[model samples]
Target: MSIKSTAARAFAAYVDRQTKRWSRRPIKSQHKVFQNLLKVAGNTAFAKAHSFNTIKTHKDFVNQVPVRDYEDLKPYIDRVVAGESDILWPGKPLYFAKTSGTTSGAKYIPLTKDSMPEHIKAARNAILSYIYETGNSNFVDGKMIFLQGSPVLEEQNGIQLGRLSGIVAHYVPDYLQRNRMPSWETNCIEDWETKVEAVIDETLPENMSVISGIPSWLQMYFERIVARTGKKVGEVFPDLSLLIYGGVNFEPYKAKFDALIGRKIDSIELFPASEGFFAYQDKQSEKGMLLLLDAGIFYEFIPADQFHEENPPRLTIGDVEIGVNYVMIISTTAGLWAYNIGDTIAFTSTKPYRVVVTGRIKHYISASGEHVIGKEVEEAMRVTVEKHGFIINEFTVAPQLETPAGELPYHEWFIEMDQRPDEQKIKEFTAALDQEMRQQNSYYDDLIKGKVLQPLKLRVLETGAFQQYMKSIGKLGGQNKLPRLSNDRKIAGFFENI
Candidate 1:
C-alpha cells in the first residue's frame, strides 16, 4: 500500500472510534445539541421574538417555536441578507446558500462559521467510513471529480452568495486539491452542456476513482463520456470504485448506472441540503444513513400523516418509529429554529438513529384523495424495470385530470429511454408499472378498483427530453433536481408539447 493509503486508513480508524461515542448514545447527544442551540439562540432576533429566554426544555421549545417553512422564516432571513448581525444568527452568515424554490422564488439559506464545518465533516467521514469498513483507501491517490455548479459566486451586502455546492467548492481540503478535477476554468463554465464537454476533455486521460453528484446530472456526464471514449466508464478508468450521490432517490437510475459503469462498485447516499447536513450511508451493505445528532443541529419529527393538522404531535429521535414517515424538523446553529426543510424521512434504525429520506413534503400527487409520493413511484419503476427488462433513462409522473370525453382520469407518466419498447412491450411495461403502483400504495389500488381512476398512461420521451426540459427552465446545472412527481401540470404540461 502507498503511504497516503496507509495514512488514510489510520485516520479512518480514528474517526470511526470518535463517531462511535455519539452514534452509540444518540439520545444523549441530541439533548446536548438541543441545550447548546437553545443557549446560543437566545442572542438572535428570531429568538427574542419567539420568547427564547423563557424556554427551558423541549416541551417549552415546542410551545414557543412553531414549525416554519422558508416563507415563514423569510422576514428574519431578509434582515440577515441585508448585512444585519444578530438577526438570524449572532452575526451575518459567512455565506448564503442560494437555492431554487417551488413556491418561494429564490431561497437564501444561512451557513454560519459554526455550522459550515458540519457540512464538510459529514462528507469527509462518509468516505472514511467506506475506507474503514472495506479496508480499501488507495482510491484517495487517484483523481476525484464532483460534478457540480460553478464555483464563481455573487456578493450581497459583503456576504458571498451562491449554490451550496459552489460555496463548498471554495473549501476543498488541501490534501485532495491536487487530485480533484476538472480544471477550475472548466468548472466555471456558465453553460452546463459546455461544462460537461470540457470536463470530459480534462479527465479523459486521468485516473478517476471517486465521482460524486446529483444522480441525474451524473447520468448526463457519464453518457457524454461514453459518447466520447466509446467505452464503459469502468474500462475508461479502471481505478474508479466509488460513487457519491444525493438530492434524489437513486433506485430508478441504478440500472442505468450499472449498465454504464459495466460493473458493480460501491456508492454512498447523503442527506444534505442548504439548511443542514443530516445523514450519510455508513455501511455499503445497508440502505439507510447514520443520522447526525451531534453535528451542531438538533432534530425533531412530525408524523407525515398528521403534518397538515394544526398541532401535529412532535417527536424526538427517541420517539420516532421504524417505517413511519415523518417530516424532518431542524434547529441548526445557522439560526434556523423549528425550521421545516420540507424533506420527509423514516428511521430504519433507532439505536444509532439511521434514516432514509422518503420524499419532499410539497412534491407529491394528491390531486385526488390518493396521495402518491416520490419513494413509491421510484420503487415501482425499479421493480417494473427489473422484472420486464426495460431500461429507463429518466421519468416523472403527473395527474391527468383532463382526459378524453367519457374517459376516467388517470396518471400520466413521461418516460425517457435510449431503446424504445415495441408497441406490445409498451403495453406490458405500463401494465407491470400500474400493478407495482397498486401494490405499493393501497389508496391507488382502491381508486383503480373503484373505477374512480383509470390505469396510468405512458408517453415515451425522446432521448435527452428531461435534460432539454431542465435547460429550458434555465436550471440546467448546479444542485438542481427535476421533480419526480408534481400535483399540478407544470412538468406534465411541458412534456405534452414535446
Candidate 2:
C-alpha cells in the first residue's frame, strides 16, 4: 500500500475511537449539547427573547421557547439578513444557506463558524467509518465526484449566500482537492443538464472510484453516460466501488441503478439538511443511520400524530421509543431554537439512537382517517416489485375524491413504468399494491371492509412522466425530490394533464 493509503487508514481508526467516546454515552452527550447551546447563546437576541437564562430543564425550555417554523422565526432572520450581529447566534453568520420549500420565496439558513466545521467533519467521518470497517482506503487515490450545485455565491448585505451544497464546496480539505472532479468552470454553469454534460466530458476518461449525489439527478448522468459510451456505468468506470446518496429515499431508484451499473456496489445513505447533519449510515450490515448527538445540535421529537395539536409534547432522546414516528425538532449552535425542520422519522434502534426518515410533515395521504406515510408506500413498492419482476421508474399516490355515479373514491397511484405489463398483469400489480397498503395500515383496512373506500387504482403514465413533471416546474435536477404520497392532487394533477 502507498503512504497516503496507510495515512488514511490511520486517520479512520482515530475517528472511530473519537466517535465511540460520545456515541457510547448518548443521553449524556445530548445533555451537554443542551447546556452548551443555552450557555453560549444566552447573550444573543433570540436567546434573550426566549428567556434562555432562566431555563433549567427540558420542561423549562418547552415553556420558555415555543416550537417555530420558518414563517414563525423570520422576524429575527430578517434582522440577520439586514446585517445585524448577535441577532440569532453570537456575531454574524459566516454564510446563509439559501434554500426553498416555504411558500415564502427563498429561505436563508445561517451557517456560523462554529457550526460550519461540523458539516465537514460529519461528512468526512461517514467516509472514514466506511474505510475503517471495510479496509478500503485505496479509493482515495482515484477521482471522487460529488454532483452538486454551483460554487458561485451571492452576497446579501455582508453574509455570503448560496445553496448548502455549493457553500460546502469551498471547504473541502486541501488533500482531496486534487482528486475532486468537474472543473470549477463546469460546476459554475447555471443549467443542470449542461453541467451534467460538462461533467461527463471531464470524468469519462479519469480513474473515478466514488460517485455521490441525489439519486434522481445522478440517474440522468448515468443514462447520458450509457447512451454516449454504449456501455454500463460500472464498465466505463471499473474502479467505482462506492455510491453515496442523500436527499430522497434510494429504494425507488435501485432497480434502475442496478440496470445501469450492471453490478452490485456498496451504498451509503445520509440524513442531512440545511438545518443540520442529523445521521449517517455507519455500518454496511445495519438498517438505519447512526444519529449524531454531539454535533452542536440538540434534538427533540413530537409524536407525529400529535404534531398539529396546539400544545404537543416535545420529547428528548431519552424519551423516544423505537418504531414510533415523530416529527423532528431541533435547536442548534446556529441559533435555531425549538425549530421544526418538517421531517418525520422513526427510530430503528434507540440503543445508540439510529433513525430512518419516514416522510415529511406535510407530505402524506390522509384524505380519510387513514394516514399513509412515505415509508409504508416505499415498503409496499419494494415487496410488490420483488414478487412481480416489473420495473418502476417513479410513482406517487393521491386520493381520488371524485367518483362516477356508483363508485367509491379510492387512492390514485400515478406510476411511470419502465417495463409495460399486460392488462392482466396490471390488475395483479394493482391488487398487490392495495393488499400491501391494507396490511400496513389498519385504518385503511377498516375503511375497505366498511365500504367507505374502494380498492386503490393505478394509472400508468409514459416512461418519462416524473422527469417531465419535474422539468416542467424547473426543478429537474440538483437536490430536488418528489414526495411518495400527498393528501391532495397537486402532483397527481400534473400527471393527469399529461
Candidate 3:
C-alpha cells in the first residue's frame, strides 16, 4: 500500500476507536457532553437567565430551559449580531451560519471556536468511519470535489456570515487540501451556475475519487459534466467510489444519479445543519444514521404528534424510542439551549441510537386534518417516479384550499419533470402517488376514505419554473431546497402565476 493510503487507514482507525468508545455508552457520553456544555457556558447571560448553574440533572435542565425555535432566540441573536458578547456563548462567535427555512426569513446561527470543531470533527469522522467500516482508504489518495457554497464569507457586525459549507470550505485540513478541487477563487464565485462550470473545468481531468454535496446540486454538476464530456461519470472519474450527500432525501435522486454515474457507488448520509453536525452514516450495513452521541451537543426529542402542545414530553437520548417521529431539540456548545432545529426525525435503533430525518415540522401539509410530512410526500413521489419510469427534477406540494364552492380541498403537487409524460400517464401517476400517501399516512387515508378530502393533484411545471422560483427567492442552489410540503398555498400560488 502507498504511504498516503497507510496514513489514511491509521487516521480512520483512530476515529473508529473513538466512535466505538462513545457508542459503547451513549447515555453516559451524552450526559457528560451536556454537563460540559453547561459548565462551560454557565456564566453566559442566556445560561444564567435559564438557571444553568442551579441545574443538576437532565430533568432539571429540561424543566429550567424551555424548548425554543429560532424566532424565540432571535432577540439574543440580534444582540450578538449587533456586537454583543457573552449573550449566548461565552464570547463572540467566530462566525454565523446563515440559514433560512420554509417559515422563517434569514436566520444567523452562531458558530464559536468551541462549537466549530464539532462540525469539523463530525465531517471528518463521517469519511473516516466510512473508510474504517468498508476498508476503503484509497479515496483519500485521490481528489475530492465538494460542490459546496462559495468560500467567500461576508462580514456582518464584525462577525463572518456564510453558508455552513462555505465556512467548512475555509477549514479543509492540510492533507486533504492537496486533493481538494476547485480553487478558492473558483469557489468564491457567488453565482452557482458559474461556479459549477468552473468546478467542472478544474476537476474533470483530476483523479477524483469522492464527490460530496446536496443531491440536487450534485445532480446539476453531474449533468453538466455529462454534457461537457460526452461520457458517463464513471468514465470521467474512473476512481470515483464514494458519494457523500446531505440536506435532502437521496432516495428520490438515486435513480437519476445511478444513471448519471453509470454505476452504483457507495454513499454516506449526514444530518448536518447550521445548529450542529448531529448524525452520520456510521456503518454501511446500518439503515439510519448513528446519532453522534458524544458530539458537544445535548439532544432532546419532542414527539412529533405532541410538538404543538404547550409542554410536550421531552425525551433524552436514553428515552427516545424507535419508530416514533420526534422534533429534535438541541442544546449546543455554541450556547443554544434546547433550541428546536425544525427538522423531524424518527429513531430506527436504540442500543447505540440511530435516526432517520423524517421531515421538517413547518414543511407539512395539514389543511384539512390530514397531516402529511416531507417523508410521506417524498415516498409518494418515489413510488410515482418508480412506477412512471420518469424523474422528477424538483417538486413541491401545497394544499389547494380555495377550490370551487362544491369541491373538497386537496393536496396539489407542482413537479418539474425531466421528461413530460402524457396526460394518461400523469393521471395514473397521481393515483399511484395518492395511494402511496394513503398507505404512509393513516390520517390522510382516513380523510380520503371518508370523502372529506379529494384525491391529490399534480401540475407539471414549465421547464425552468422551479429554477425561476428558486432564483426569485434568492435560494437557487448550494443547500437551498424547495420546501416539499407547505400547509398553505403560498408556494402553490407562486407556481400557479408562473
The per-prediction tally of clashing pairs is 0, 0, 0
Clashing pairs in 3: none
User: How much is 175 displaced in model 1, in angstroms?
Assistant: 0.8
**Each model's lDDT:** 0.91, 0.91, 0.88
Winner of 1 and 3 under lDDT: 1
| Cα TM-score of candidate 3 | 0.96
Clashes of 2: 0
Candidate 3 local lDDT, 1-498, one digit each (tens): 779888878989998888889898988998899889888887888987888889999889878988888889989999999999999999899999988744567889999999999999999999889888888888888999888888778998789999999999989999888889888889888898888899999998799999999987898899899999899998999999999999888888887898899998999999999999999999889889989988889999999999998888998888888999899999998878899988999998987789999899988888888888898888888887887788777789888878799999888888886678889998888898999999999999999889889999989988778778888878888779878888888777788897
Instruction: Please provide, for model 1 over 32-129, each residue's C-alpha lDDT reduced to its tens digit, 9 standing for 90 to 100.
Output: 99998888877888888888889888999999899999999998898898899998778789999999977789999999999999999999999999
Report how far off residue 487 is in candidate 1 (Å).
Answer: 0.9
Evaluation by TM-score, superior candidate among 2 and 3? 2
lDDT of 2 by residue, 416-445 (tens): 876689999999999999999898888889
Clashes of 1: 0
TM-score of each: 0.99, 0.98, 0.96
How accurate locally is residue 422 in candidate 3, as Cα lDDT from 0 to 100?
89
